[model samples]
Target: MSLFNMPLLIQDTAAIEGDMGMLWMLISGILVFFMQAGFFLVESGMTDSKNAVNIAMKNFLDIAVGSLAFWFVGYSLMYGADMGGGFFHWGGFIFSQGAADLFFQTVFAATAATIVSGAIAGRTKYTTYAIFSIVMTAIIYPVAGGWEWNGGWLNNTDGIMPAEFIDFAGSSIVHSVGGWAALVAAWMVGPRIGKYLNGKPIEMHGHNQMYATLGVFILWLGWFGFNGGSQLAWGGDDATAASQVVLVTNLAASAGAIAALLFTWIKNGKPNLGMTLNGALAGLVSITAGCGNMSEGGAVLAGLVGGILVVLSIGFIEKTLKIDDAVGAISVHGVAGAWGTLVIGLWGVDGDAGIGIFNGGGAAQLGAQAIGVLSYAAWAIVTSFIFLFILKKICGLRVTEAEEIAGLDISEHGTIAYPGKRQREME
Candidate 1:
């Protein structure tokens, strides 16, 4: 099956048959479900313990709130019906999908909204963040999602020259959506206290690398579903495509980790495991948009470039932009997602581009990808900032400085994640 012409799930009836297939999908969903833990672990592990519980709680709550929001309005708006003018008409305020496909997408909707939690961690009030999460899953994400994924104007399906912008998974649709939101939130929240002293960056190390590492592994495991399940079945076109997608994803991740490790070691004169793991994630995010269209070699190249992009983007955002992302979510997801989306034009199989830099050199496809990038950034930034601004005016958006220094576990939730250590400090 050609990349652009892969069979839809509805076309292949037998491909979805048997209890085994259903089991695979359900299990895949479960795995993807557990990625939330991975996000919490990885993010909290990268930041100080003072904010560990805060980060974890945001991840947990965003999923809870975002899921409900997506079910109510996001799914319908994103996929219900394509408006004539490239907008998605809101279907309704209830959970009613024409098929199981809608439910599957809801899980992805939750994933996208949850990605912002880590970016705005350490400062955002729980209530404010909760409202933002709800708005994101229910409106912002779904509206943009309809643009490309659900046959919106961005699809270019009806243009004079038929052009279809493809996102194999969700480089822009989910990751970039969350990434841009993170950018806006981080900007509004400002840097964490003491994060920038005298206009210089301060190192705020994570409390636990173990938690972060475990989170990376869980995300890696979950990505199998993240990409594979997009094929929408376990047999025939879906099965074959899923298998290839997994292969490419794994190759990209491995290459990314290696590239990041080497680059970090070269620049810092040490093997930065944290950054190396992040590189792996960067590669995954980069490949997500074009995973179905690229060959093995293309996948590796994408991963390698993605690894470098994350390192640079993170450093730039933190040091230059003065944004305290807490978990590097903006770089790993936002920058890398843009890379992945553009890679489709560069390395797509049908394109004149060869397997490497020599083969796929065209500007038209690049322009199309750029359109997707700008669209996502504009929508996410504008809507996120407006929503957060409204939230700040309505109910306050940050906890007290005293509450922050004392730790969110105690101040926000009135409990300690590590009671023993907290007691020791108190005494």
Candidate 2:
């Protein structure tokens, strides 16, 4: 009998559903992959022009290295058969039936790993960065992902938590994990040379505001796929729900940008462009966890809070913590991601599923969200510190003073992003 004409195949609803779902997932994955360009532009534009080439190189290599690492072991560790009571998994090595799913997940792993690059830019050794990307995608990100998305203890229906933890698209699992790791990495790498003077941070401005603004817009575009694709299905009601998710995502991003612009204008007496850009990102990260569950109003509220928190957190990290994050990745992703995840416990709702505390669900959901947030932070911080410390001892994490001042493009890559008129004049 022909496969297409088989009665069982024709009658199977799941088979038809899988076909559309896979196609949507692949499309979404491609959109997420394009986010790498966004990251490159944002990182390069936010840092010194001297390091622009190096920044671009790192971002490119992050996807390259992260994809291979995830394919080799990361996917298996995340989605393999449950072992040791869901602490980890084994098997499913190489490729399996879900190639499309694997491709989709690989991009997400890369996104988490790449978030750290901006924090340690301008001063990191290229070789060391490569190693970090591999380890992060293969081990750090996958293990955390297993815990939430792969039937691990955190999201287990019968787990220790009062209520199942909710991270619809990994605000805590992906963003916070990356953010916490970036925090540790920035600390270990130390601040860039001349970043501090007399125990106070010296102001450093990005060389190109236009590039940074363009990057923000690109990221905003990519986020529709990032949040919408998490629905994991594209048939019937799922299609409508995905559309709603995209709508809320857009609203949150706009609200976040406006809030940050106003807040910074009030505080600094002028609207800071960089802060405003980050504010949009903060809003996006804040809504990622609850976009599918929350109403548009809830998303705006979350984004508004995220924008204010990011500005405040960036100031604290710079002034009080003395952590020099070149692009504020830690504050925008980690802090806002945590805030977004926690808000789900307060505002999350899906039709009749009242799972938020303020919606009369009580403290169970809130407690679960808190536990998930803390666990991810602890795991990311501890593991990142250990890995960074070892790498520092083995190969050294930062460039020398001469190398840094000379610019990573010239010192590390032996090329300049912009040779300027000197080359033309010489010719």
Candidate 1 lDDT tens digits, 82-191:
56777665666774643345556766777887778888777778878877878988899989888876667777755621346767789998899889998888888888
What are the per-residue Cα lDDT tens digits for candidate 2 across 1-427?
2211111100011321568888988888898999999999999999999999899888888889899989989999998889888778866667443777788889899999989999988899999998999999999999999897877889665768888787878898889999999999999999999899998999889888899999999899989889887877787777787787788889889989989999999998999999999999999999998887777777888899999999999989999999999999999899999999999888677554556777666888889999999999999999999998999999999999999998999999999888983377569
Model 2 is weakest, by summed lDDT over 10 consecutive residues, at: 3-12
Best by lDDT: 2
lDDT of each: 0.79, 0.86
* lDDT for 266 (candidate 1): 97
Count clashing residue pairs in model 1. Answer: 3
Q: Where is the poorest 10-residue window by lDDT in model 1?
A: 4-13
- lDDT for 271 in candidate 2 is 98
True-vs-predicted CA distance for residue 75, candidate 2, Å: 0.2
